[model samples]
Target: MTLSTTDSVATAGTAASEQPRPEYPRPDLDRSARWLNLNGTWHFEAEDADSTITVPFAWETTASGVNRAWLERGVYRRELSVPMEWEGSRVVLCFGAVHHRAVVRIDGSLVGEHTGGYESFEFDVTDFVVPGILSELTVEVEAPADKRAIPHGKQRSIPRDDYDGVSFTPTSGIWQTVWLEARGRTYARAVALRGDSLTGFDVVVEAAGDTPADAVVVARVLGTGETVELRTDPTGRAAGRIEIDAPRLWSPADPHLYRVEVTVGEGESADTVIVTSGLRSIQARGEQLFLNGERLYLRGVLDQGYWPETGLTAPDADALRHDIALARDLGYTLVRKHLKYEEPIWLHEADRTGMLVWAEPACPSRFSAEAAAAFEAQLPALVERDGNHPSIVIWGLYNEEWGLDWDIPGSDARARAAEHAYETMRALDDTRPIVENSGWSHVRTDLVDWHYYEPDLAEWKRAVAAMAEGTQDEFPVRLGPDFVVDKSYYASDAFPRSGVPILNSEYGEGFTSLERAWHLRWETQELRRHDRFAGYVYTEFADVEHEAAGLLTADRRAKEWGGLVPADVNADTVIVVDLIPLRAGADILPPAEPFPLVAHVSHHGTSPATVRLHAAWLRAGAPADGQAAVAARAQPQSSTPRIAVNPFELSAGLELTVPAAPLGGRLMVWATDEEGDLVARTFIDAAEVEEPNRRGARSDG
Candidate 1:
């Protein structure tokens, strides 16, 4: 889920059954029964003014119930009626989010406006509203036509440039829930939760409006099981701490959360706000990441957080929960929410279901003063709003130096900008690690991660091995107009690289689903076999338009990996086999002697995983007199007479003989766990497609 939030949408400010998103949106800040969902239907139109699009789904998407060209600017109008009983309270109109920018007005009069599409915003419309009567609420939204030079993230940088492979279909206008709430004149405007699993928790409440000078704030905390009376300061802020006698750590295995309720006063006139958070600590020491003092690997996937039918919005709230479940099923501990401010409910689900996340913001495509300001604007909202969740383990600022023109290494200003963003994020929340620029061009970053999409299997393995050996710094990773392909300067010439965990934040670029699966198995096995890399994130979890590197389709269906299982490849304990023919569809030619196949067990589990090691080598159906050279041989695949080794320790090496069948076919390789499960598998065509020497691989000596 991208940084998207939802609100219950039952009616146009009335409790009706026809709303699309009926769940109360702000699970992070619950004020009981004083809110009304405004998510059903709104007057929507672009420059042409011919359509009525849905509120939560973008105008271009099919789920929006409209079919038209997506325009940059759109307007939404609705008439809201507030219940007479809630007249004495302050009426606040809230929006889960709006794309790019949104301008609010009541009865054709300006109320307020908000910029930035990913975070939530609201306005207190107390004076403008007349209770029990309809009030005209109009929202004018503008998502700039120029996709670049703004924090647009994975959306296409050059508007309708179909050749742009990285960007997906861009969405515009209101794509999240809109609602209204009633609050007391004095209430908790913002609640900041901080602490860890070991010590305790801290609560900082910002009191707003006409809070009495003697108003008392009591927070009935659930996780710590204590009601601490917070001391109010002169600036209308109440701060307190809760100590836990028995603290339970939160992790992917056990995601325990703490419930918080902050009451502003004592009697019936008092107001309360509810929020949820968890306690967990993540650290990196000498090339390994630890959570709750236990070593853990970041088996993460890059998620674009989009759907085919719904451009950027989920059809329903359960889709948010399903994304987390899918990530877990793929054997990933963490999901790097790539480039999009995802759904807050997604973060909530991760908190409840025990999933780690590396959150990122939509990034501008080029560098400029305005772009930097817009890019920096998203940081505080992202950090302050989602900081309370324990599922977020890392904060990512720039991605591959997108807005910086991909020249952070050469340009001091760009490098400083990345470093400055890191400092800004640290100032906001110093609990988790921050990647200055994920993938490469790291001016300042906690993890020395890189992104590569090399399709060559041999080269990929070599790069992975070199990185694991801590020698990858030898290569320069600069990318820009002035960058020379032959340049020799390291990405970080001055910054020290020792002791930091090396990870591949982005990789996996194969041409087809079968090839992608092949790359997945080989690349993953190579990474695990070394056991030196701290972690890796596949290029993506699902395909988005032209970017076909996903292990799953855009609809979340698993892509065929030619019978290879993702869970087995991603398991903490795994078996990896080294093969000469790594490329899919490549054939294995029989040598005069048997070929050597070395397999190793890469286990990151707390305990050793000794599953029964088994292998099946399907020999080609060649004639019995196959002693002759198979340079131009062909054969049928024969699974019979399977080669089995008893208690075969790979340290002794396994020898595989190739016999070409009469017809051209494949020679399969299968690795099984002790429990007879299909832990690992792969295959290569056995015979050469043509006569070998006739199409000589090398000139005669």
Candidate 2:
């Protein structure tokens, strides 16, 4: 079923109305005294109508009480009284995010202007503010209708269509929190924390202003009582390393974080910022991706960061936390934040909740010298802002050749551009692996990835078999017509065959009930059977508008198929089946004909054991009707001994015949251990015959 536009956590009731996103905006570098939350009500003007709307929520969202599309431009005004305590400090006005371009003014004086909708920006408003009196603050936002030049991720001015299936309604005005912070002359502008295998952390602190030579940066590990002091150089920067004996590594199972306090000055001139750090490292060796020296497989989902009522912004902090918890409950170890830079709060939740993140930058549709310059300029600041977060492991640059029209693989221009972007990212931070452009046209990348959405199960099986056999020529046939066969860019022979690890980053048919669950299990097994495969990420975690392929509805409600799979398929004890009789797109069945049903079951549990296969047929009816039709038992199949890394398969075939009838029914198959414990179950439906035909004539006629 399709989700209503207004049905969401934000519109449910007053639960979120009382306090919406009241937490500190920046959790990575937080200072309560130096920060203020401007997320309540503000004077808003849209379409020449004066109204009051929520600050952080975009004007176009229902949460703003102005549930309408934004025009070319909008205005937001708010009056603020600067605290007397911040008299001698630098009062900076900060904006979490504003869609497109924003111009700021205080008391009718222009302060600063910024472009780009996803990153944070701030201006020092100390000169314009009266310490104890109210000051008028105005923000002008201009969101153009053009999608080619702007780096608007999945946002379209018009309704979504086939050409832009993933795009949603455009959001304008300030979509994130606006606040005022007071800091000393010399303060910590940013911090970078790197984790080493030897339980040591290399910390680099960047200060904003000139340093006092005597000023030393003090780093204190809050709970562990570990401290390190380093003196700043002539440039007001300090770098040092601190070792933690026997550190507790951070993983999806245990997301442990260490609190750090960084102080730049001493006595009354001191400025302190609290930071959070995690002890973890990610590395790619040969054909495998490892985390902290252990082989890791990323079972992830695609998160678009959209809300029914709030557009790109989440309704509140609780809403963000709920999405993370939901993904984790469905057996996902990671989430790829697709095509948008999310708020720091979302990454904070991922860090604490034990879910890894694959972060990507928003991209423009058309390429130009100006567009390339804008992307390059934002890369360093983006890395500096989100570098300390432990949850983000993979840094995805561009997606599916969004900006570069000539991003064909072998082209020198495409290769040069991709290499330049890669070098730019590596210069800023060399901690995570960079995927130059996910899905296609891989010039320089650490991991080779692909996006496939073939609905035919047989074709998908063949495609995976070709990958296992290293037969690249036969891949196009098994990949179906939807697969792009252009080898001009990939050069046919040079296309990802060895060295780097390969990932099927996106794949899902989005069917409902039994069909969807069957497809998921079958596709997952196909990838796992290939020895060189690193991992796979399903197409999505929840539905987004016209893209109804998500396992959950757009409002985050679980579908009927949610209960069909095990609690955690990543666990050791699991069974997956690939049934051959239930063909894709085959809804009708012929009765009175014998057919062979083959089931290929893969056992991933510990220890070898015997399992029993049972089959039953039931007429379509409610449970109370008790319309049982037939039952059978196949010979027991013995599975091989449990392997830690690879799954062992067991195949069995049975011949069965259905009685000629007009009634529709379901064929149910179950796999159980020797102790009668249910491992997995699947069903294939048989359509009802309208009328019996004899000699090419209907009986009713």
Candidate 3:
């Protein structure tokens, strides 16, 4: 019997409510009509196992509300009565994503089965549908944490902490959206864009068919206010060379997307589909990344889609938008969504908000021949699904060499599998950059990636700077580390370059460590100069179980992971405008011993200015001594110009002159005049500049 419409997690299947409709299956095509969101309560039962849980979101996630063990085998059932209008057309069942193995049956009849958890697969269900009553649809899904040769990133067999080297909670189950789309026989299968700084753009339309060989194809470029149409040859394939004069390039700053709608056959016999895209080029020249023929710096952060209540499945479109918005607020223009794929709506919002995206496949723990083949097959579908989103410019194939650990005996097979996967992705879609491996190991691919953790900012900078000078042969590999500055490997002399643009694919792991674990307080960007260091991700977006490395708490509350803050400052609070004093053509200051370089600061506000010294900036790279002090030359809050001085004269030997400011507010002062503004100043004076102040931890004094 097919399971149908039940609210309980254990027995719910693919009911209408279980579909994620708001994701807008077609983002490139504009439609003002509303569709149903089928992502909630459905009837389910394990065909071979014992229990049923929520669909899409993993069984282990809090969103399922099950908190039970991962089900290896299960039968999911739901009911959907098609509208009478769709009588002649075929009914298609579309699964946004399913884990490992899946078999679908309609009206108690076997329909089809698909293998692979990360990519979406669909089948026609028109033959199995009844004319007027509610038809039953059952989907049997099997996901065994088997270790074979699949491109699993970091997923493990059981929910454990040892995920590669990351101590994060385990992930399992569907973990994505599921839905259905009813369409005509000859619909658009895949739409791709290939462009560059030289040739402009070439649109490739891949289609499915068994129709007559004389089918005509047409592609229309939908611009701001005009549409350019191009016709293709008789083989149901089309290509258009578009030369946009001074094209409005798509980047994090201005994401201008061009819409393209293709139609096959003449009016009465035509089938049309729309795909949205942006015309731009991204390539690496040595260690510099060029976007639209200019050196582009990627200011990004790691975004793991999770929620306190929803876990993997987003609560609504707002949740998805919130992630991009938060990243934007933290001065990040790009987001490297780690491991898991997001709902289409997430990419839609990213496109809308002009945020750059680095998309990665979900981390798979088990590997096998079936898994590899399944993975390879699903790549085109994945490209088809998110290709319209201009925000996604990079495709990451492997992360930190996690599941495809090259140390094993079958490592060559797995490595070949990963290479083939990335190669196939390129074959299917070559508009964006493809990362072979995210960290350390070289896979002889388009982009070389690496991971490192070093506390020595000076050393890291020097190494990267040397590479910028072309002392290294290969381009600079991207760096993804757990911490911004790792103390242990800080001064190590090992800096390897394999010829690629250097971007921080990962760093800044935890922002909430201040409250949970003090030792984990190295999640801030104290020494990161945006111009020199390029860009980096601030740990994570939310706290994932034991991994408290999030700029936001598990419940979506904001936390400070990097030094960057929101541009919109509270009118009532003192706004600390950080203005760096630098000389023309001056090199970065050499890192001194582990001591705090204190700057006596005083700000003008309605009342006394008080700042909370978060421990993030005080770890590792900070000075060892703690004797620095700020004093005023003129009275505090004075508009008159005067040099500020350090009370302890710590900056006496520094390049610039130091003066003291008159005192206005006490330590952690409370200001008056809620609306009034005050001018404040500070001075640094000390025999020696001590390390940044630390709370709870032992002091040098």
Candidate 4:
């Protein structure tokens, strides 16, 4: 029933307030249709910004109805008239978001300015417009045309950034919905809501305009139909708390939410907003993460939030929901909204579908007082806008020492900036775990995490085991031949830990899709073999531009994994086949004699699971398909019913005999539940030697 980009937006004189995305832009603070969607066609200008481009889609993307090569600056202009029905009320213009910096003007008069491209900003235009007259609205956007530092995130540009090939297309101009909403002359300017077990829900309201001395704030929980009321101050600021009977706890298995409606005043002048919150507690008490009093293992993937057609913006609202659904389908419990602070609609969907999220901001490429300030300044707005969602359990800051210049250990100023960011976020909200400098050197943090990409399977297992045991502290990360040696230390010298919960935030490698699938089992098994790890996020959820290290392509289509589903490797329970390489760190099993079949079984289920290990031999036609890595997901020529059946435990050295075929067959091993569902699997070539998928994917200087 959906159409292509041609029908995504209206053209020319079709200026109806209702755009393609008719839903309220801010679902978290839903005021229904008090807002008119201004996301359609807008007059655009720049060498690259087209004469006319579709709203909410970046100019770089084809969905914007423009063919832009480079995007650094863009000017957007449009004219709109207020609805005749709304006369005496205030008119507010809201930008879902614009990149880097936005300077807004009304009728050539300066209205307001906003920095940071990932968070929403608004301007009240009550005095600037006549109720029924058309007014000209213009917005000027600027990103790094040269090397002027800004939190660019994974956005790659010729001059602004060269974060390997990992980064993708830039998002410039108006990439999100722009709209105008009617509000009371006196309205709630801000609503800060938080939900937890201790307090059912707490909301603080900051109102605008003059308010009666006897004005009151009232909040009601729609689920339980419970309510709370508080008297407002003369300045129209009020705080209210609501507790419902038999509150339902929220979890990934069941994300029960408490939909709420908050009122600021009384009668016709009353201002009301709708938001959703959930009661849950997440803590890293021991060497594990607990969600709602239950232990959790975060099987997460790094989602870059880019698309081939729309670049950084979603082509449609369904696209946002699809990513979450795809991750869930791949047997992942969480999605790390990598680098970019993803759109609010994505978080809203995560709340409804019960998926965990790690929210982050775009990091400036270089470091300075300006860069640090710019980077940290967006935290409050980021938290204030998205904190109510139950899906965002972790707040991640800094990825692989990006904004800090990859020198946190050598510079105290950089380290202090990292610490200050953590402290500032703590001051804003202490409910979620904040990673000071995620996957780099943690000067201060609630969780100790790392990102190591090693292609050698043998070395990878050793490194993962050692790190999990708290032995390997230094992980050398060489950005390129031009950069100095940068090692991601387990912890900074100033903040040594007896050990906090460890998560491998970014890790995985593969030369080809088949090889990636083949090595996926090894890499996943290596991490899961260590019980100390809280979880891991694969290098990516989908490929971005040329950075082809994802299970899925940029278009959300599944990358060919040699007939293997990603869920096969990314599962809660896995059978980690333990075998000595024929040579050093190889994937071939010699055809000399019968090798001892051993497996280290790791299960994450609450109660033990009844499972069986199965072994088989697959004969290939030639040495072509199984040339490098092991052939995976190919039907076995013959099957061994069950090698061992045991209650799920870390059992190793299970007795079995697996002979390498003399002519040309590989040895296959796997684990299955009592019902014969594949939970874990891996294979070893019996004929050819293995080749490693080396890291340092790019060698660009």
- Tell me the TM-score of each prediction against the true structure: 0.86, 0.83, 0.71, 0.88
Each model's total of backbone clashes: 16, 1, 75, 1
Please, what are the lDDT tens digits per residue for candidate 2 over residues 67-178?
6674778888777777777777767788888987999988899999998888888887878987777777889989877756667768874423223545778878889878
Error of 2 at 508 (Å): 1.0
Candidate 2, poorest ten consecutive residues by summed lDDT: 1-10
lDDT of each: 0.71, 0.70, 0.51, 0.75
**Candidate 3, run of 10 with poorest lDDT:** 647-656
RMSD each, Å: 7.0, 6.9, 10.0, 5.7
Global fold similarity of model 4 (TM-score) = 0.88
Residue-wise lDDT of candidate 3 within 1-701, one digit each (tens)?
44455221111232344343335444554321212234554565653444555656666566665554456765666676665555554456667667667888877788998876667677767678754567777777777755234434444554432354453333455566555544445555556654454335566665454352445566666553334455444666666665666577776667776666666555543556666667667776665566777665565668777675556567666778888887787556678888767777788788877988889886444455566675567577677777667688788876654445332223767767677877898887776788766754545455544344433434444554453344642223222344222111111133334345655555432124432111112122222322233344445666775666676678778664222223211112221212231111111132332223232222212233323221111122222122211211122322212233321111111112212212211111111222332222111112222346776997679
Q: Give the Å shift of residue 206 in candidate 4.
A: 2.2
- Residue-level lDDT tens digits of model 1 in 434-473: 8888777666678777777667778777877776666765
Candidate with best lDDT: 4
Sort the candidates on TM-score, descending order.
4, 1, 2, 3
TM-score, structure 1 vs. true: 0.86
